[model samples]
Target: MRAGVTLRSYASRYWEIYNKISGDNERVVASTFRMGLPEDSELRESLTKKPSEGMWQLMGRIEEYKRLEDDRLQSKSKAPMMNRPRQTGFPFRPRGGLTIQKPTAQMGEVNVTFEEPVHRILDWIKHEPYFRWPNKMGGDPSRRNQNLYCIYHQDKGHTIEQCQVLKDHLGQLVKVGHLKDFVLDPGDRVVG
Candidate 1:
């Protein structure tokens, strides 16, 4: 429902109730609160002598819980770079607070892991990356928010998992001892 007068009018007419605080536009505010708010809202349940007080209390509780959760996660997974030096430009940095992993070069070729911790390449992309965050959460779930570039075609929309044209590209890289760190899905491998 739309905010302001439209929603207020709808709520007052439907609920047959008026807002206690706003004597001037009591009907409008009260109606809106009833219609707009969810059925299982804690604020609604905690309505007291002062409706605003109850709402404020509920907000404070929510903030407290959110902050607590943030603290817990921060202590648990803590970012890898807390004590480490910043990453250099020429060579990408290793993530997870682990030692830097160098590619195992064979003859004239260099093999490296495709997986690297996320970096903010652009300002706008931080909020919305080319690769979406993973649906499941874990120790390294932040990688989900990183931009996933399909190395095979350098495309943004589809990962190699769904790219029929570039099927088994990851396996081929693995076969050649390249991107040894990339987790290979068995279904994506090409079968002769």
Candidate 2:
């Protein structure tokens, strides 16, 4: 039978330690072993370092310090107890239960899929295809924002990105109407 190797755990931060000879250099591809502590899996993943024997002893000190710090914080945050005169009264209960519920069939849900840069003019249903997408490799800045106007308010201060008023109006529509949960809250808070 082969003899077993005993490994000691250092602090959570310094979970991995590398053992090196006096004059020998660390290897390029180092195999990291588990710190043998199942609880500290998070700290084990990080702080991968050169191997050493003293790191484990240092870990014990660090864990001890952390424990002390935690204790001090808990002690400082303790709430004081207060003494007060108490009076007792008979508890009252309702004879019957009443709960209002909406009809499930009335609630309708609609999913709308639209391509980018589809601009809707005065008429809500019919929209003219007006879109300009800039090339990632710095093609042309002129085509960047040909029409930078809010569809709801028609302002230049901000695009649909910073349109809070429009978003709130859409939310109000969802709340008042029988629109489905998905339609009420779109992926992006845009009126369209």
Best by lDDT: 1
Model 1 residue 27 CA deviation (Å) reads 18
TM value for model 1 = 0.18
Report every candidate's CA lDDT: 0.32, 0.29
lDDT by residue for model 1 over 67-181, one digit each (tens)? 4443554477564213212211111111212122212222235332333221211111222222222222234535442333222232233332334333233334446554444
Would you list the clashing residue pairs of candidate 1? 133-144, 134-144
List residue ranges in candidate 1 displaced over 4 A: 1-53, 80-192
Q: Which stretches of candidate 2 lie over 4 Å from their true place?
A: 1-147, 181-192
Which digits, one per residue and each the tens of the lDDT, describe model 2 over residues 1-192? 012211211221122122111222222211233344233433333333423344333344334444544455446756321221111110111122212121112124543322221121111211112211111223354654433433334333333333445334333444565223424234654553
TM-score of each: 0.18, 0.21
